[model samples]
Target: MDKVFIKDLEIETIIGIFGWEREVKQIVRISLEMSFDISKAGKSDLIEDALDYKKIGKSIVNLVENSSFFLVEKMAEEIAKLVLKNKQIKDILLKVEKPGALRGSKSVGVNIFRKQ
Candidate 1:
């Protein structure tokens, strides 16, 4: 399947199990790889024939910014569900990362793959 990817999308939100975490917004880096067919768009060179990634990104930002989730796992699942709402999407690979979450690590996070 043809793939469309969005990388290093950073957003601030309330996410974590700690009391302080809930009280403050933290930055989370999200990346997504979507399985889609690009043949029609490539052939016609028209945006109307292609998947609208900007719209998808905006929707994800809205969802994450308004949510207060304790785990990246749940966040990822929710994101997958939202993206999968588009019947044209065959599946998605999503990654949600919290930078500086661990003392010594650059980041900690979850990677999930979901199919429509």
Candidate 2:
């Protein structure tokens, strides 16, 4: 399958198990890779014929920013569902990370893969 990606998407939202985490927004980094057929778009050279990464990114940012989640696992699931709504997508690879969530660790995160 052909591939498309949006990387290092950062959003601020309430996401954690702690009480303070629920009260404030924290930064979450996201990355996604999905199967998309680029043949038509490549041949036609038309934006309309291609999967719109900008639109997808905007929607993801909106979803992450407006919603609260206690786990990156759940957030990744939701994101997978959102992207899968596109019939052209065959499968997805998603990563969600909470940087600085661990005191001494750089980040904590989850990765999920789903197929249609």
Candidate 1: which stretches are off by over 4 Å?
none
lDDT digits (tens) for residues 54-115 of candidate 2: 99999999999999999999999999999999989999999999999989998889989999
Q: What is the lDDT of residue 25 in candidate 2?
A: 94
Clashes of 1: 0
lDDT of 2 at 12: 96
Alpha carbon lDDT of each predicted model: 0.97, 0.95
TM-score, predicted candidate 1 vs. hidden true structure: 0.99
Task: Assess candidate 2 and give its TM-score to the true structure.
Answer: 0.97
Which runs in model 2 stand beyond 4 Å of their true positions? none
Worst 10 residues of 2 by lDDT: 102-111
C-alpha TM-score for every candidate: 0.99, 0.97
Residue pairs with clashing backbones, model 2: none
lDDT of candidate 1? Answer: 0.97
Residues 1-116, candidate 1, lDDT per residue (tens digit)?
A: 99999999999999999999999999999999999999999999999999999999999999999999999999999999999999999999999999999999999999999998
